[model samples]
Target: MKKSIKISLGGLAFNIEEDAYAILEEYIESLIMHLGNTPEAKDIVGDIEARASELFIDLLSGMQTITIDMVSSVIEILGRPEQIVNGGESNGQSDKKSEEPKSTERRRLYRDGENGIIAGVASGLGIYFNIDSIVFRILFGVLLFANGLGAIVYIVMWIAVPIAVTTRQRMEMRGENINFSNLEKNVKEEFNKVKQNMEKRNVSGFFQKFFNTVGQILIAIGRVFGVIAKVIVVILAVVFISIGLIGLLATTASIFFGSTIVSLFPTFSGVTLAELIGSTFDLGSTLWIVIPLFFVLAIPLLALVFLGLRMVFRFKMRDTVVFVSVATIWIIAVTLLAFVLFFQARSFTIRETVRDKTELILESAQTSTIRLVANANILEGVDIPQKFFNLDDYSIANNNGKPMIMGKPSFFIGKSTSDSFELLILKRSRGATSQLARRSANGLSLLFELQDNSLVVDPFFTLSQGDKWRAQDVEVTLLLPEGKRVYIDRSMEPILSANQTCCMSWPDELVGRIWEMRGNKLVEIR
Candidate 1:
């Protein structure tokens, strides 16, 4: 049995052997001599002693006294005083300092508060993806357009990702191996960083203090709602994953089985989405539009899926490679999409109208009232078996084995400048230029006839063969003399303008009634 002495370590009483005490005292003296008497150095030494005290207790294992071997073991774990000062290069341990240590653990994401401007979120992402932090900063600034989405994302990251405070954690954030040498180096680097920051305080003290105060307030708010925030993040992540999966599946289906899947949905004139896109754009531009459109829709969804999974599972991926590759592809897709859209928009730059006028030969002696009726057989000979698209008084139909756009003409009545009745038809369309628009408008076919006191008008106007639909529309205005009455046919209900029927409760009520033009407005003649 050896002699024992009671000593206080880390506020705990420990019985130690005389020989063990001698070695421990020598180690403490050496540490003080090597690391100067600065406050930071004293704190570091105190931490080392606290760590050693805990190790000694573990090594005792129910023994009443700490042995010389226990002291040696504690010193080895904390590293010798010379080794800590020189990064493990003292006492024949030069190999440990010289040779690089292989990383055994994956890198982790941590906020670099020491170098961060605000909560260190951008800095953490910068380290994770191996990209410059300024790039992310600019990206966040741009995202501010989406209703402050950038600020929301930054706050979320600030709360979710922990700050790296310890030497081991700092090393892990940088993907470095955790060893004695690395730990010592990390500590020294942290001290140097602090010193440099202190020196730079005079340069930007106001901004630094402002950010610090705001950061502290935000952190306090985050701490108060930490649990709730985590729950919200999990719920949002799940929702995003679901949306991403559904969108990805739909995009894949549209790309691979365009016709089969697109057939289920209603399109312009019974045409599938692919067929419509192909018809709208030329073949050379189609590929550019289609491929980039797919990626433009797909990349973000895939990223959402990956991010959700990462947050849920806490797994590591090939972050740098995946991020750079996907980001490059997304950027290219957006560029191509924007380029295609710019030129396509030029196609609809101008709008023009083609007008026609007719003098109605109504015999005032025969009747004071005129009959305005619609031609029921508007699609008379077209082989269209079913109507697939009908919107805004326009529809698509098959005209002689060719798909054609059919639009119902808008009808209105007003006072005539003269004592005779007249009809005006205006065909309007859009194209690349005024001339092209006029040509498109002229291609519209509206059939109507005036005989005796009755007017017969076709409800629908058809596009001429081989003419593309450029929003072609027909407007028929009837000018009636004062004291002259006209009976509107029920079939004209579909083409009657809503603005012209505001005096009536509904558009349908205005049809199948006799009305007279008085004071430039049509009044019902009860």
Candidate 2:
């Protein structure tokens, strides 16, 4: 039989055999010294005692018998003198305090913590959990980071947990003995009044009214400012987004239309590459613009009117009228601006000047001498057969040493011009250099100068979104059927001749040879 001795460990009333109680107290005290006399370690010791009780009961096997050796046995099973300890977590709450925010956080000090940069509650926490202070600090730092909220929360914690000045206060902060005698049987219970008081978060009486009023005012002001700020931010964001969209639309139009779009719409007459580039495609049209305008202008005014009505039914319409008047003015201004923009985009087109040209000539000769003057070497020394002007599209004209007496016969046509003409005669293909005749064409125009060089783009071709075609006049001497002279004008005769369009041929031996009326004599360009 085990006789019970009345003793208290850390203020917890315990009835155990004399030897068991002494050993238990000694063991718990040792734990406290090691755990910095914190409330958490005290809690762990209590758990150890309870566990020992159960172990002791199991050993007895149905008799209400207990033994100190049984408690020692439980201690050994738990591990070494240091290892004989467990964390201060209570029944079924091992992960709760670590994971979730406690209904009451572990503040720096007792009574909701005061004057401590660190959570004194955490220190007391070390006592309650019987964990190391360093462990708690690391754990807190990690939790703070993992939460993803900024460091403001940690600062809040620093402010909330109290500092422990006195030894008793420190103990209380740890949920330990407020009075040394009451330390054990759950010190958390002893601080119930303080905890409840902390729950209400009652600060000094002097601060109470002042803070309450200040907080209320601040909240009201903040709400109003927040409303305005949110509105502005949304407005700005919408504008930015719209601008980007409009720009994209313009660029897409510019690429596809090129000069064509400006050619079609007269409303968009002034539109250019710059206009296309500058226009923002942001379509805040119809509902997007109108709905927002209604709300922005109406909400505040309605609220004011409602408040005024409630205050005095003597509801003078003057202020409401004033607001409406101002809003109307703004609306009119904006609408006018929109109308102006709409009107500006009317009708448009794109037309411009072009000057590059090429001409081919075939002439009649009286002698058998190879007359490859203009066409002689005209097609040489120039970039031709370009993709822009498919040389395959160019028509071949043959001018043998005979006039129109032989219908398209007597000499083969094989030659080609640029700024100056070079004509050659084509005969049976010997596949040698001697097969081609020289001096095959005569100079046809004054400014043209027997040019065989392929047409180069006019350097000063002016491009515009307009349409106009001016006609040019050219002088020509023609060979008629009666061997007489004939003058031609495009205005008078749209077609120079049904079969012959002022024909010329290889009638000269040198390049740039011009024909004169000095009894049908041809001369070379000086």
Candidate 3:
């Protein structure tokens, strides 16, 4: 049996037969002696060793150890030490003499990190297809104006393509054969290009210097903008994360704690949080509304935070995984929200209105006046705090252990067909069916009373207990005789009708103003 030994090549461990190891060592020593002890020589040797290790591993496949035959094959492919030393001149002469076709190796797609602007995709594509990188960059920029499709495509390509890091990878990207001669030629070409650029800059005249200065200024400006962009992203991440966390916590508490905490806080519309949610959705459908709600808000915020971290720290992540996960979650959340809203809208399809009229008899008196005022006793009895929650449009209160909905009441003045004074109350509500709508409309508990010459009207109307709010509203019409006069109170401003056109802009400004009914309009009397 041949003696086997452990060897490390290009930082990779391998098991090789003693004879194979000796051959490989001798081949590498000859390359070192021919190339001389320079940094370039060291790099060349490392690349050759790495390439050889790759080839050996490929050839051994299922073998337990590398043999001398494998090592000899790898060295032959790399070429002799004398050939490598004079390959640049001899290969060119030999190709011309033999009239042989050039290598037809296929090019590979890889991100050219050495000559890239962003993620190296454009540069890599340029090298692979034998085109200018600026053309691809400009094309991508133009596509960005076509509804941002270019940006999406670029991100996908950046994530999918691998970066050309090793010398072999770079050679493959340029369709060059992975051999020592091509590698040396490529390295020398890069070194010469850099040297020429430096020499040109050193010899640059006035215009060249001016252009270089302008380029430097632009680069500085770009760096400043990059910093600003990172700052903006960080700020947005903080704001989004804060809002998402708060919304998620609130939703969780409402779901587990049964809205007990939510009820304690009053909404901007003077409605309890529980009352507003209960009005819009049923308890059974709350999950569909709440769960997707969290993902819709939270996922984007989490993604923003991740992006901000990447920008600030210049760290890399599994971008494909993060992007796909976030996109999927956002789509599902939006779909669920749409579905819940669509079904909930069906609850307000039909409207029904209920009307009640009552006649008032007054003793014969000259200059009879009707004063409109709000009933404070009823509001006090309901135990509703007088503190306004900017809810002039609607309000909710607890009445005898039941939920009550209140809405603004509007009034209109009209001439009586008969000589008697009448008051009409119209209550309106909506439901899935007309019957249900009518029942809901008839369930209101609004009150109005006429004491002496003063007419006390509730500024707001209330719905019955356990009724979901379906855009409930009330309108009060006062049918007055031609000779009767009326006075409006300032407290009733919230419930004033919007159809008035008596040169008065504000309803509250018309308070304490006396008006007499003529044919159809109420004419102001000084």
Candidate 4:
């Protein structure tokens, strides 16, 4: 049985057979003798020993102790001291020999830790391209200040590039041919530089320390700003996502469910919100408008959310095609919506008004009590599913599976110059031309009846079948003779124009109060 001995190689502990340890020691002694007792020699020897130790570790993966065979194999791979010395001379000769074509050496990008500030990306790039690292650093700094793209590129390079840790890696970083001679030269140069720096370290210690402290402070400030920026981005991302989602959901709901939800609120104008939007574009064209609108809003929001995640997690998604596609789609959507709105606006260029008067024959009485009430109760008995669109004025109902438009009629009361009571109906609408406007105005169906002194008017009117909304509206004015007592009902408040009411609260406070038309105004009877 062979005796096992403990040995240290390149700052690492190892168990080796007695014979293996002796062989390794002899090889190291021979290297030292050949290299001499210089600092450069020590660096080369150290690198060699470290390489050998790495090989030994790999060879003895399952074994408890390294054998002589493992040591011999490692030494053979490292080559003899004479070979290394002769190789340097041969490399010099080969450089002088122009006839001998040199093979192209593969270079790897690595951060040059020896000559770098922050990360060593610029230093590594400088070494790779045989340029001064300071130049690259200055350029990057300029780019960072100029357009902010330099920072992003620098960060990406820092994360992507590897650091040159080994002597061979350091040589490769400089685009040098990887061989024993070049590796030894690189190690020797690095040691000489290190020694020169050590000699001046005492003289520059204070300045170096001061600069290091400043660098640390700058790095700390950068980190704080980075964190703050991330927080802001995340908050913006959340907001964008919330808005996009809500808008998409609302738009989708409206499209699928029709104008049922919008119909709940009463509009001051006779036109419903859905009808107004629908007027700009037909239901088919609206699909194009809403779809594009949704994409335009939602895509950017989603992109913001993704960007936030990428920034926080340090992930890269190099999807230029997807970005371009989304941008193109958004542009298209915007263009289409603009085009539709442009034409829709022209439809309301002209306005037309049509008026008709019907004289009321009242039964002869001392004082006729004319009660104004809305005729909404007429549809209550009709077998149809009625949806109140605008308060009680407008509603939508299915008549034999066809959609019908309903509108509310507003009223204004004034004293007549004539002795008899007269009802005047004024229908107004907007269109692209005067003729179209007149046709739109004439399409409004407003019905009212006079039963003795009780005048019943429909609260809402309906447009002709298949007629698109052109802001159609109706105005009812009751021309009452002087001294005719008129009673207003509470139900007519929605359709009653408050401006014509002379500051009196319509229907609510004015209901049950008897008012006589005195000239142009209706004065309350005491």
Query: For residues 1-526, what per-residue lDDT tens digits would candidate 2 score against the true structure?
Result: 6578765433333456767766766766765675576555555565555545545545656433345876576555433344313433343455534542222323233422332223343444565465665676666678768884434444444444444544345544554312222233234454464578788874556555664465456556656876897676666555544554565455456544535764575334323332222221123343334334344444444544454343333332325565687677667656755664454332111212222223334243331122222122333332231211111212111122101100111211222223212222211111112211111111111122322322111111111111111111122222222222222112212212223222343322222333222233332223
Error of 3 at 470 (Å): 1.4
**How many backbone clashes are present in model 4?**
0
User: What do the candidate models score in CA lDDT, each in turn?
Assistant: 0.76, 0.37, 0.74, 0.72
Number of the top candidate by TM-score? 3
Please write out the lDDT profile of model 4 over residues 1-526, one tens digit for every residue.
Answer: 9999898897777889999889889988988887777756766777677767777777976577889899888887776778755644556655635532253455678988777776778999888887899999999999999999898888767655777987777866766544334556677777788889988765646666675676556556677877898788777766756675676576565544455553453232223334445543545645656666667666676676666566456553336677888888888888887887787778789999999998887675564668888776757633344333333455655444344667777788877778888899999988989998899899999888877777889877878877767777889888889778788887777777865744355555666677788766788888
Worst 10 residues of 3 by lDDT: 266-275
Ranking by lDDT: 1, 3, 4, 2
Candidate 2, residue 283: lDDT: 36
- Which candidate, 1 or 2, has the higher TM-score? 1
What would the per-residue lDDT of candidate 3 be over residues 314-335, giving only the tens digit for each residue? Answer: 6633366658877988998999
Alpha-carbon runs more than 4 Å astray in model 4: 1-192, 199-218, 249-253, 256-314, 376-401, 501-509
Of the two candidates 2 and 4, the one with more favorable lDDT, higher being better, is 4
Question: Candidate 2: lDDT of 102?
Answer: 24
What pairs collide in candidate 3? none
